[model samples]
Target chain A: MLYPRFKHFIEQKKMFSLGETLVVGASAGVDSMVLFDLLLKLSHVWKLKLVLVHVNYKLRGEHSDLDEMLVQEKANAASVPFFRFTHTEKSEGNFQEKARTFRRSKMEEVLDQQNAACIALAHHQNDQAETFLLRLLRGTGLKGLGGMKGSSLSKSGKKYIRPLLPFTREEIEAYAEEHKIAYRHDASNDDVSYKRNWIRHEVLQQLKQANPKIVNHLSHLSSQLREDEEALEYYVEAALQKVSISEDFGKCSLKREIYNSLPKAIRLRLSAAVFQKLFLESAILSADHREKIDHIALRKEGGKAQYFLPLNVLFTRDHEKIYFQKENVSE
Target chain B: MLYPRFKHFIEQKKMFSLGETLVVGASAGVDSMVLFDLLLKLSHVWKLKLVLVHVNYKLRGEHSDLDEMLVQEKANAASVPFFRFTHTEKSEGNFQEKARTFRRSKMEEVLDQQNAACIALAHHQNDQAETFLLRLLRGTGLKGLGGMKGSSLSKSGKKYIRPLLPFTREEIEAYAEEHKIAYRHDASNDDVSYKRNWIRHEVLQQLKQANPKIVNHLSHLSSQLREDEEALEYYVEAALQKVSISEDFGKCSLKREIYNSLPKAIRLRLSAAVFQKLFLESAILSADHREKIDHIALRKEGGKAQYFLPLNVLFTRDHEKIYFQKENVSE
Candidate 1:
């Protein structure tokens, strides 16, 4: 069932075209190990060319190196091409942010060398649940709170695909164990100091104990949310089309009458859409910020500037016309 | 902030017409109690009349009677009419299901007595999240998993409004505590035997403890999902208008080519729409059910009996004419 579902997802996304290689990010974890093995088995059936990539961040010292060795041995057994990268520099900022940047950069390099059509990572359902929780903690808006995308474009313009995203971590572990697949253990996963780790070790375990199907439930929720999210984007696009007064040099103005007339929920979404167009980040706009913007559009006097935002967008009223633009540099 | 938002929501929905009384189902719980007080306060400003209705299921013995007393006292203090009903019959089915049915019936009776324009309930953000989780667990499709609506029409044709749907349970609790509003305690809430209660007590609490802001975050996710759900509906409606062969006598047919060409997500949504028109219930068409219909439509058969889903709706094929109608009695 897992293999068939993975095949269907890969084919549906067209993750790999004819003669184009796929770069798999193998972390030597059960999830990634299972994905790597499945891809190895299905490559002939699907006519897929595979390139294995592993990142040794050196954060775990000898353990990380051991994991890289395991992945290399697995790739050797499968007679597949493999690439490995080691990063010695300590990540200065957030561990999650730094790890993400490091992984993406390494993956891009592998893609360029292999000319891979897509980079596949083994982010299963539990990962999605953790992500949803993380985004919620950070006060994310609709898009940010949506968790992970099945297929997204990386920073370097390479396609990143998660074919096993809908599967739970437990399922992946069961598959790996049943197949006698050897994988590395990441000590950081049990640290609990990091938010994701805490969610994984404490929160998710408790939820699983209570329900025994928490990951599946959360994954289902994400898919449902994803569907709803797409529908919302359409309506927001429609509202944007009807209400946008001007868009020049990435500065846009939405007609006040049009903006004010929308329901508050729609108004908040529209505001987020406008900011997304300029900033390209899905920061949660506060309700106060939305209300302030609504006030500017409804009550503020002419020529008065009102700073309404998450991305610091400003709405300046000039008689009946509401001029919207990025805030001045001085302010 | 909550009161103002509630006021804005009620006014926007036009839930109560001019000179018509509004009935609120005030169970004296944190949610309904806050709603009761807020409506009482806003009634003067909005020029509206208010009536409070309470249903004591008598499941919790003394606790249930206490809740009724609290609601009646509060209504009396506000100089508003109060209505109370007690049910001695124990629920034979699930406790939540029985309570819901009883509450709705009581609300209807109160509405009739007051000639109310709408019946209001305090289903805050947490309730919406739980509903979403429950529907997802049950393998529900887009519409069922979409959660609660801000406004809906009851089966008895009475308007139902949930002004606090966007507000989180924490926010309502904070407001109630801040205003020194007295609310009753429902022992059943902590039972954790029911699926929703388990989610509320176990899953959500774990998420909240990890993030400390999970309620608002998940609620934001729901709001975004709602927007997406609306957008999907718009596209579905447009597609129905363009590709629907016919929609008469509670039966409809869609062009196979048009249906297959739609994005998979949209195809699932269209199936849901078609099912909804016939069943008036979104639960009948699961994800697997939609896929089955899609599979039937894709098969290159000339004319055959199409798959009939859980509902009594029978889908058949007549060469180019794909047909959907209620199952014939003789068959």
Candidate 2:
């Protein structure tokens, strides 16, 4: 029943193509092991070309190598193609994040080398919930709160899919147990630095008392918000055409009448879009910053209306136009 | 300094006008008491008319009567006119919610009688945070996550203001203590029944270890989402016009081509709005339900492609028009 439902969800979401080469990102964890097993089972039906990829960061010394060996052994036993990458780089600040970047680049490289279609990950509902709670606690907008998608195209135009996304971690664990799938668990991770681990083990557990189905609830909210974000992006794009009169290397100008005429949400989003246009990668715009922009946009417009954002982006309004200009664009 | 900042916030937000009649909802709690004191001080500067209104549900025995007496006594000491409403009705199921409805209607009645500009409540950042968290935990879309506004108009177009929304409970308590303001405390509250109280006292406390500024973050996120929701609503309204082909007595027909062309978020929102139009008030459409609709809309177009939502709303699609009809309209 679970297998059928999982396949159905993947088919309904149009996550992947049958018989296409898929780079499976397995970490020797229960989720990835279960994911690998499911895909192996699925291969008989859909004939999906499975290429198992693992990156051993070697953080846990012997345990890490054993983790890599387990994945390799599974791949060898199943008669599947496998690729392994070792992160020999000296462990430094933000080991998890840096390792993730290294791992993804390596996986994508394999995809390029093997002409594989997309990378398949083992991220599930708990991961989605943890990510949303982390983003929420860290203070993010709709885009961040929207959490992960089951299938998405990356910035490099490469595709990735998470077939296990619709299921919870408990379900995956149950499946792993039922199928007798061997997997390794990372023991004694640094809870302080591994913020997501802390959230998964601590925060979400505590939140469950508030609502027993916190995981599923967060997952549902995130997917709903994801759709919301996609829709909002469309609206933002449409409003950008009307509200923004002109843009340059360091400056974006807008028509206050058009901006104010729109709803408050669009107005704020337009301001954000204009800000993003001026400085491609800017600092965080706090809610207070948005409030200030909302204030000055409508207040008696003149040259006196000038506010500086965190990135030295100067917002100035006049009789004709409201402008956001980067003061030090050369940097 | 707090007073000045508070006044500035009120003025900047355009929360109130000078010398207008304002009905203050006083519950004798610290929040309402502090609010009453603030408005009283403001009246001297702006020559405003302050009418204090308190509702006693009479559930807490003589303590409830004492709460009323204290509010009336403070109003008398300040020489401000007051109105007190006693909940003479028997206490029944969902006492808090029913009490709130009864209280608000009575307050609004006062506003109508005195031609008051707005009913001022003492909802602060904490209230905003709780509402957002509750909604988020309960699995809500962006609209629910937007939470409450600082100032808004009711269905009847009567204005209500939350002047202290920018401040936290700690700040309010500090101000109350500094000013030697006396306030009542609800001695015993049922943590099980009072969901917000449980969230306020327990859930929020647990979340603070993850982030100390959780309340403020939730408030900021809600405000940001408020803008996002408003913007999405505008887009939904726009898309609603283009996609929804026509509406009849108990049915709405949409264009499959148009609905499929729009982003996933708008399609879901459009579906909710259409459902609202047909049934007036309907049960929730889950994310799964939305996925099904999204599937049917773009899938093979025929009479066979039909989905029934909660409350007997039938969704069917053909080549040109997709229809949503209330199956049990007579009920």
Candidate 3:
């Protein structure tokens, strides 16, 4: 029953190109298992070549190995290509964030070798709702509120798509049950110590008491914000094009009057984009940094007023131009 | 203690000019009672000529009269001019909506007669959250998500301000209790059949179990959306200026290419603005009406593609220009 919904979503959103290779990120969880099943079912009709990728982080010992084995077996039974990546090293900082980075990089490596059209992930509507709530808690702007993009292209032009984003976790679980699909349940998911786990189990469960369709409403909100954000970004890009006077490898200049004339939203976006370009994604420019830049631009004083941004990027304004320069430039 | 926050909000938001006649809507509820007390305390410092308006709907017989008498007594004690408006007749349609309209009209009449600077309402953070939830449940876009504005000027440029918007209902109630402010509680508010009351008692109360600060967070979301909406509106206005060729009473002309070149958000806003201008507030241009207009403009044909927007306004687009004309005209 949900198959038609998935098909319609893919067709309506044009999530992937037909006759193209696709990489599915599977962890043997219910979400990934359902995604893998659906994609496999639609492969011949859509002319899709499915490839499943599983990474064994080795954190859970036997459980990790069992999950990987199940994913590989499912892929092999479906006659789809299966690949395994081993993670023997652990990184500092948040474990989830590090694992995501590792998985994305590994997937990108595979995508480059296979020239896959897109890598599909199993982020359902519940995940979207959780992300929305988390971002709200941390204080986010409109772009953050837009939540995850349905399809995004990486720096290497590899497309990443979330085909299950429109469906709720319950719906996916129901579909898996109806199809009698085999999946591995991760015990760590029930541990509410993790922020996302807490949100999923504690926060949303309570919210559901008020509105049973809270996840649906949150997903709808993200969709609305996404469209509104695209329109805003389009205008921001245009504003950037109009104000930009010159650009180099790690520097750019904008006419002061023209840049200041832009609305605050566009100004913040343009400045952040410039910082991201110069800093080469060292870190996202913080709201505080943007506020300082806003103040500098508003001041329009030429000499001795330097505004420092994230990743050692410093901006100084002149009577005519606002200059973005790296503090420790080698050249 | 909360006075400084209220004072700072006024100063930061520029809600109204100080030392001027200000109309306060006092309903004898705790929310309004707190607002009245705070304003009276600040009146001397801000040099404001405070005026209070109480609307007695007479729905509760003696209770209604008692509420009005309490408000009048409070105003007299504070040495503020008091005005009472009686609604002996009930209007058709949704009672809440009609009551709101009637109250606003009556307040406006008082505002005009007193030449007040602005009319202040006692809508707090809880009301804002409830409205946010109600809007989500009923299906809304960005504008609806933005909730209520801190200050808005009506069609006739009569200013209305919501000073208590930044404070939660609990905060207002606490203030009232601490100060021992006499207020009449309306028993009808406990009736959950009313959509807003249901949201307040059932929805938000349930949501508060998850996060005690949910009301504050919801208010913050509205504030963020308001800023984003402002930026979007700025771009839309700029686009309108670029595309509009001619505009008069019940008619407008716009360059097709320029209008189509604008982003969807801006296009919808521009078209809705034009429709509003032609119709003169006779009806609100709905999303469906705007979508139809968008389709008509995209078709690029002259005769067969007439769109009837709300309030009997018609739109037609040709190869070069989009024309807006009222349904009936003498010429």
Candidate 4:
């Protein structure tokens, strides 16, 4: 049985093309399994060429292999293509982030090989809320609090979609049960060592006591912030086009007076954009760093101010202009 | 001794002018008393003519009067002008909101009588965090989550300032204890009947367990939202000026094509501004309402759409223009 709400959501959001090849990031968990089942049902009507893509991280031993096997069996039953990628890279620093990045890269490779239109991920409303809470606790700014986008283009120009984002975990679970879909439960979800798991078990439950609809409220907040962030980004892009004097590899300069006239939010974003243009592709600048650079740009009594950003970029501000360059590079 | 951080904050933010008459709303609570003491100490250095204004809501019997008496006594000892207003009128609904409105009106009256430049209120960081949570649970947009402004001009052109907004409740209490300042604790603060108190005791405490710096994190989030909001408002104001075709006392007609081209956040704000221009002074349209109107405006095949907003105003969109007028008003 097709979940009417999820079907309506996908139709309304135009999450995928009617007859395009698409990749599903399936993990045999309730979230991804439900998504896979729904897409298979919809594919017949929408003329979608469906492909199930699973990543056996091999971190959970036999459990990960079982997850891959289940997804492959379902894909075969539905008469759809199935692809499995084995993750063998040892995670350093944050395990979840590393694993997620690796999964994304592997999925993009499959997307290219299949000539797929986009990849669908099963990040639901609860996942969005968890991301919001995690970012909030980490001292994030507006963009971070906005959480995941429903559809975003990757660096290599591949579109990624989260069709299940509007539905809560409870709703998805109910859909799975009503449809009698079999899914594997990952026990690691309860292991509190994962920061997200800690927040899910300890923090969200406490918040739910105050407001039963806490998850919905948080997701709503994220939507609001996302809208605002997009609006600001539009203006920032316009401002940057006018204020930026010159640009090159690893170096750029912007007019000081014109930049100062923009809003603080726009100024910070403009600085980040420049930093991204200069620094490595995967580098992310903290809000505090962006703010420090903004202050350097806007100071009234500036003679010649200089600061080193976290990404090892030298930011210099003078009376006429602000410049960014590689830290060790000479003028 | 004065608070160095506050002094620097004032200098940086340009919160007040030198040698001006200012009114401080002293409630005799630890937050306000500490503010009172700090202001009294800083007045001589800044050459400020200070007035202490106390509102006795008379809701708590003798406790209300005692609060007034203590504040007045402090004003007398400091040799600063003092004014007291007795709020005897019974509240109708939402007593806190009613009392707050009444107190604000009375303070403006005092300011007019004294020819003061602005009135100061001691709304600290924790109060800000509580407000963010309260508004979040109640479903607010970016503006509400931004929390209170450090300085805002009232509708009547009176300025209200919050100098203690950067400090937390504990910080204020510590300052009060260090200065040997006597302050009365309002028993009403412990009343869970009030939603703000419920959140403070229940929600915030739960959040604190996950992250001890929850209050600071929330306030920081507010600051970020506030900056983003201000930037969006700037663009919205500019957009409204260009889009508005005609305006009357209680009606506004805006160009549909131009309005549709704006960002969603700006579009929603422009709609609310039009609603405010046509409806009651205190009327506020929710983000959901604004979003619905935006959807109606942006529909690809539009004929004619009408929505009855919360403020009893009719929002009409035709092929050429959008109209806002009182519900019963004939076109």
Candidate 5:
């Protein structure tokens, strides 16, 4: 079903010209296995070379080693380079953070040794949806809830690409089954101890059952939101051009009469933009915070007044002007 | 807690000029009851008019009549006009659809006979959130998800104002309790059978508990989205000026090379505008539908081809020129 999509992904990546070297992050999962085999089959047509990298964090003992062996065997059959690393640290301290750090380091090491152009990962649509939901549950702003990008530059300037991100897990499983690809299953996915596991197994499943098309609906929502968010960033840039001052203050001082003349919504966004620029971070600003700032700016007897923000930035209003400065000092 | 807010609302409404008028649509609910007593107390300062309008759809039999009596006694004690309505139809259709139609008709009748300048309703922040969520779930585009406006002209050209929309239900309940005002309970709110009720009782409640500031967060999101949406509409209007040919064909013939040179997200939105203009409807385009249309436009085909939309409009392309004409066509 997704062969055309996979072909499109390969074409988009210019995979054939990547020095015949392809680095795949193998998790011993069905999705990764399917991707590994598909790349292997397309190797001749695309004039490709394959490198498989597997990282076992020693969290699941013998099962982890067995999973690594399965990936090594698959690479051996395809006559490709296989690399495996076993970490002594367990998946205990911030499982996601630790795993991410370890995986990136290992991928970078393999890429450097092999002189690979890009590192490929097996993140799919379901994972993206999980990420979006996770961020939303934590009261994230729009950018945070945009899930993951399909391509980005790694810390060492190497390319990281997710070619399978647009496809679903079921599609991958179907492909694997059709091709008779051998893959190992991770038991941790069913443990349900982690928050992501809980959401993946419980909340998402329930939502899927309630509406079979929930994943598609949510993915569509996220894509639309991403577009809308890009448009917002464009406007914020425009608003900053008109009203922003300097990076240090990040303060846009406008005539009180002029600021008030703009729409209430723009006034709020302009305030948010100023706050974000001054703090050098984006956090959710409450309606109360917005109203307080509005009140301060519009105060009849406006002396110097200060309001505290999340990142210890003080928003100060003196007469008709508002400025964001560090929180330690009193005006 | 909300007394100051109520005071601000009355002053904002310029209620001093309107004397001895009825506060219609008083179901003895928290919103209406709070508004009723606020108007009664402010009668001295504003030389105000206060009356209660109650409509009994008779769906709940004795419970519905009891709600009406509660409002009548409340208005009687305040020594204001008490108007009661009984619906013969009982609104057996979609509860929301019927309630809205019947409520407005009743409001129109009272406003006409009593010469009331405005009909005040007690919709508050929670209602706005529910409205936004509903619009989101149903795939409404930007404008529908903007929640309710502060003031609007009713179908009959009467002024409709919502004074409490910025305040939460808790604030109104607190004000009612502090002022010793009696209110009726509506059991339908807890039904959980209706989609809106499910969202209100389950999803919103959970969100509120988890964040402890969900309303403010949602309101901020809404305001920000509204600003971004307005800015996008401005851009769309500008793009339309350059590209749009006619509404009949939804005919927007952009220079293909230039359109393709624009960002993919903008291209999608511009395409949506063409679809919207031709369809003359909102919420018709899904992500898949959009992708199909985009694929056709971006395809390698050099000749004319037809793409059918769900709304029965056919998009035809001839090399660099795109046409959104009627479905019956030999492209």
Candidate 6:
């Protein structure tokens, strides 16, 4: 069931093109193995050129090597090109973030070498749900709750695709068992980040008791929110265009009438963008800050040039226009 | 601390008018009782005429009556008008839902009798979090995940306000203790709905181990999503205005080019709204349906008519126009 659905998702999302080369990230885990097998089957239909890439952080000593060996053997059996990166550096602070950077850079290296259209990773439904829950727990806004996308481009311009994003872990395991795919157990769970483990083990499992399909629900929510965020970003840009009266160096004035006519969400996003464009000092605005700024901007009079945003951004709203300026300018 | 914040939330949201008569619902639980006390204090400053409404569902027998008595006693102590309703009728068939309906209608009845502006309910932050989590577990969309609003109008044109929405259960309890506000425990937890109990006891409590301030995060997400949903609704309407070529009875034609130019989120929403206006049969479109419909409508020259929505709506797309028509006419 999930096999056909995976193919359908790939087609519907237009994640791949005919004969497009892809750098596939594998951890020898069941999820990745299933993704590999699914893409292997899809290779003929989509004419996809597949290259498997694995990273051995060596944090798990023998376990990491064994995982790499299994993936290499499987790639050889399938006659697929394999790229293996072995990390010899000592593990330091922020293991997960650092490892993520190391792995993505290595994959991009392989991606460039192969001239692949994109890198494909095995981030399945469970992973997305866990990320969403983790973000919700730690506190997040609209964009955070949107979770991961099916296909995204990195800041450096390399594209990545997640064909297995909508498939649940159970479905991946089921697909793996049905095909007798060779995959490793990822015994390195002990070294995995605490927050991810807490979410996957404690939060998600307990929530599964409430609903057997909670992962699917969360995935659905993530997909919906992502679409929503896209729409919001578009509107915010449009609203910015409508409201901006003029933009000079280190300052932008927006027509208060136009800005006030926008929806609350778009108004807030526009304000944030205005600050980012003019000052760039207010890296993040808390909900309270946004509300206060919006209060003054949208208020129908009695508020003038007395509003202040973080650090050195001055907010002034008159009957006609709202002006934001950088107070401190470096020479 | 919560006292001032509570007042601030009400004023910031413009939840009430000066000297406006308000019907507040109290369950004798600490959350509502604290809300009752806060409003009692704010009554003078805001010149609010307060009427406390309590309903004893009698499902918990003696406990329910005790709750009513405690609320009535408190109302008498404050010299505030109190209206108590005792349900002697047999509680059957979805006790919680029925009790909620009965309670709201009774409260509204009193509202009309007193010419009150709106009903103020003591739905605190914990309730919002619990609702959000429970909805997530049971499966929900972006709107469902948005949870409750601070001030909302029911379909019947009556308004309801939740002033304590930003205050957590702990905050409410702490405020109650600080103010020496006497409130009953409601002693009816045993009769509460199973799903709510499961979520409150299992999911949220387990999640709290990961983040003690999870409630605040959930509340924050809800607030942000609510704002997002509002923005989405606004954009959908705006896009509809641009794309709609004609809307006649049981039919609507949209400019396919214009529709495709809009964001995916707004396009999907516009399609749903079109179906609602034209056929009214497709009450809810699943993600799959929306994706399929969108695929057909946006695909260049590949699809012409033959798209079917629920029961009796036909979706058709040509080179320039997307048309929808109701298939059945009962009259």
Question: Which digits, one per residue and each the tens of the lDDT, describe model 1 over residues B100-187?
Answer: 8888888898888888888988888888778766664565444564556788897678889888987888788899889998987777
lDDT of 6 at B323: 78
Instruction: Estimate, for each residue in A208-251, the C-alpha lDDT of model 5 and write its tens digit.
Output: 53366656555556666676667656655666665546655444
* Candidate 6 stretches greater than 4 Å from native: A44-47, A190-193, A243-248, A329-331, B88-93, B190-193, B242-249, B329-331
* Each model's DockQ score: 0.32, 0.74, 0.30, 0.60, 0.27, 0.83
RMSD of each: 5.0, 2.7, 5.2, 3.7, 5.0, 2.5
Best by DockQ: 6
Off by over 4 Å in 4: A244-257, A275-331, B244-261, B271-331
Residue B237 alpha-carbon offset, candidate 2, angstroms: 1.9
**Taking the tens digit of each residue's C-alpha lDDT, what string does model 1 give over A193-240?**
888898788876766654677677777666656655665655667777
Q: What DockQ does candidate 2 have relative to the true complex? A: 0.74
Model 2, residue B32: what's the lDDT?
Answer: 92
Report model 4's TM-score to 2 decimal places.
0.88
Q: Please rank every candidate by DockQ, starting with the best.
A: 6, 2, 4, 1, 3, 5
On lDDT, who's better, 1 or 3?
3
| Cα lDDT tens digits for candidate 6, B1-331 | 8878888889888999899999999988888899888898899998899999998877677778888889999889888899988776675587677788889999999999999999999997888888887777778777777868889999788999999998888888888889888787754354435778777766778878878888888887887788889899997887767645444446688788888888998888888876675555548766677787788887765646668878677788877788777776587
Chain A TM-score values for every predicted structure, listed in order: 0.84, 0.91, 0.84, 0.85, 0.82, 0.92
Comparing candidate 4 with candidate 5, which one achieves the higher DockQ?
4
lDDT of 4: 0.83
DockQ metric, candidate 1: 0.32
Candidate 6 lDDT over residue span A202-252, tens digit each? 767777776888888888788788889989999888877764544454668
The digit string of per-residue lDDT tens for model 3 on A182-244 reads 999999999987767887998778567657998988887787687688888897778667644
Candidate 6 global TM-score: 0.94
On a 0 to 100 scale, what is the lDDT of residue B104 in model 3? 94
- The sequence of per-residue lDDT tens digits that candidate 4 reaches over residues B264-313 is 87898888876775566678888778878888888878689899887567
